[model samples]
Target chain A: MTVVTDGQERAGDVRLGRVGRGVRVAVALVGIGLLINGSVRASDDAWPFGPMSQYAMSVPDDASITYTRISAQTDAGTTVDVPLNIEGAGVARAEIEARTGEIVKDPSLLQQVADGWAKKHPDKPKYVKLELIRDTTQLVKGRVVGPPTPAVLATWEVRR
Target chain B: MSARTVATRAANWFTPAIAFARIAWLRTVLYLFVIVDMHAFVRDTRLKGEHPGLYQPLLLARMFDLPKPTVFNTTALYVVLIAACLVGASNYFPRIAGWIVAPAFTWWVLIGMSDGKVDHDHLALVIALWVLPTVKAGRRGRASYNDQARSESAGWVIRCVQICVIATYFLSAIAKLRSAGWALTWPGSAVLTWAIVRRPHPVGEWLLHHPWMLHVMQWVGITAEFLSPVILWLKGRWQLFGALFFLGFHAANTAILLIHFLPTVVCWLAFAPMERIVPWFQRRRASDSDAGEAEDQAEHGREAKEQAGA
Candidate 1:
């Protein structure tokens, strides 16, 4: 009977030891998590934000962005403001494909063009306003390479 | 049974209390009160001026979709979610509130995530919605401490939510290491300056121009996140200081950014034991075990009286 009691006592000690080990493991994991967190906190462009940086930089999906307004000084010299749904960022590098004066129906492809410029000048402006006129679409087909300039705007005939 | 058996049973009974303390420390203090509230401020500050009308629902909808929502079709869904949140805050039919509010909030977050610029605040709401359904916040478990049984079994979900909150900091800290510039500039006025130039609060704007203020904020932010484990776990004056620092941080954020979630703020009130404030409120209210025994004895005494009368 004493032998059986002694074995039981040893088994209980082992179980207690295992429980202690588990708690230690938990504390250690939490510590590692905190250290990692502290290091990552030091970075500027963090995760959730980094993943969506492109989209935030992308033009507003809906036809109209609240803060930005699109006003066109028409050929008649009359300025009419119609909100162009500004989807992406970088005003200088953005290109718009217009079909006979109206913006293109599919804006998804614009993202690809914007992304290409973003790769070259990651920090510089990528927002380019494209005024699509009937004949102008052919003149500026691929990526617009640099920032929006008087020469580029004049070449594209983007008056507004 | 021997005295050892009796002592063991008593110790076993105290397990839940220890667990409760752990949960309260993490859930109420760090995640719910500090980290989550800070994210709310970030989102709120971002959506200012002309952006409120368009951004509020748009951001919420984007939470539902990480990129590209199917369509921003459901206005009714938001209203229901708001209503459920209001009710859940009141702790009425907590289980039901948890179920409805969690899904509705999740739906809104899915919509918010659809946009690339997702606010971290929605993650907190998601975790809260998931856990609120299982907690014994309402009267459901008021009859006995066995209510912990129902809660302990749902441990996986609780841990997941905890993990999510912890990861936000972990990931953020890791990002800090990637660039030397972030270390030198971070925990400084640049964050505040960016806010001031864009959307300046009276106090924030005033403080931004003060070169010393930015330095103070930067150090505080770094030190706070770095010492989070210690500040949150050590119970006493240190815990209170931690809570206050957290409050000040979020309050500053709110002043600068207009996001408001009063429920979350109230939940933080759990940090300081309300027992002292109300004095005898919880005790006078009586523990479930006491109430249960009282009811049982009352029933027995009434039965005896009835039999004697008969």
Candidate 2:
């Protein structure tokens, strides 16, 4: 092949290899859009370009996550386990659990959590009390499920 | 030759040319990582596709009004993503393959992140994927070039990624400011306890007692984030120091939190002298060729001298 030294042609047919004025303008516009998209207005799924906001804010001193079986008294006064307390949320269970810990200290937030829960399980009867009882399971990482050591961390209560 | 030295090359404004070998090297690393990343999610992705009800379209997906995320759709998208990465990495039909890699991987990222567990660490990587295809990089394995063809465009592509790296840090600082109340009383120290209670490791437990240290780390993290843009403008030792500092930041983050931004860290190659490897090799090749030419000239000189005597 003859030597072409004008610094523009490639043997391959790649689109941007030639670097035209239009391509440069397009790249500049795209770059600006990318930089702005995430920081200005990130979409619901995820903004790869936005502010790295995860763990950006500080967790309060009293903030903590507890693994416990939440129990609530049914209208019939029978205590039943709140099944929504735990599931297959890898690592995120901590955040949910932590939020529960927060609601325990500040019962005023109970209405929001309850409203969301009611929306999810519309059929379940309203409970009189919400208490997270520690599971007596020894947590194992990879193998068998160990029993959580049961401990109670109470959050909300109904006078009725 | 007008590309100048490694240290000055990036500084050259609008230097459109780039070494093709560098493109080849970067593509291999990026394509492999993107492929492996998708591979890890194959079963999960396929599951998402199968369970159309669970397929929550993210903003981009919603805007595109993509077809329902049926098991067929999810799996098919991944299939395309993986195939594009493989063919692009292998450069089987290079130009076509290169064009295929970016959008396929992008679609996979949007789909994969639809569950609301989005990580911004891969944005620079995605940018890399898109920008990389623009350059007509040489064959795989080689990392240097002897020609000026396409060097300018490669430079532009790499510059875009480098900016992304800087943006990650620069914007992270902005994020911290938005939330971190900035005083010593800022409960940033509580993050250790917050994370520890979830995982309950010995080191984390120990650190919990040392709240003051966590506070110190918070200040350090913010400072590092704010100063991160130095990687672009800083020269010589300072630039290297900035890079090392960021690497340490990632390392400490992974060690403590078990969160690794492996892709973004890999994209840090844009700031590094990676493209220089090709230029160095090219310099050696040129020198060797020059030496060979000098030897031939000397032999002809000797022969001509003999003929003159005759």
Q: Which candidate should be chosen as best, given DockQ against the real structure?
A: 2
| Candidate 1 TM-score, true structure as reference | 0.47
RMSD (Å) of each candidate, 1 decimal: 15.1, 11.9
What tens-digit string does per-residue lDDT give for candidate 2 at B200-301?
A: 666665765666776777788878787787667665567788888989999988877766788889888776544445445445555567777656545433
What lDDT tens digits, residue by residue, belong to model 2 across residues A1-160? 3333223434542334333634664665677576666655553244555556666666655443445445667676788766542122111333335455465666654443344445456676767667656543222221123333567766577543
Model 1 agreement with the true structure over B1-310: per-residue lDDT tens digits: 6776664433222111211222332332322332233244332222122122222234333344432322333445545655665554444454675687666555544433322244444343355456546444413322221111122312323334434443433344434434434443354324444433334358765664463665576566556645554542345566677667767766766775443334334444434432132213333444444787556545433322221100
TM-score of chain A of 2: 0.46
lDDT digits (tens) for residues A3-111 of candidate 1: 1111012111112233543453354356445435534442112322221111112111121111112333334455443222222221211113121112344333334
TM-score of each: 0.47, 0.66
Weakest 10 consecutive residues of candidate 1 chain A by summed lDDT: A52-61
Report, for all candidates in order, the number of backbone clashes: 49, 21
Cα-lDDT of candidate 1:
0.37
Highest TM-score among the candidates is held by which one? 2
State residue B54's C-alpha deviation in candidate 2, in Å: 3.5
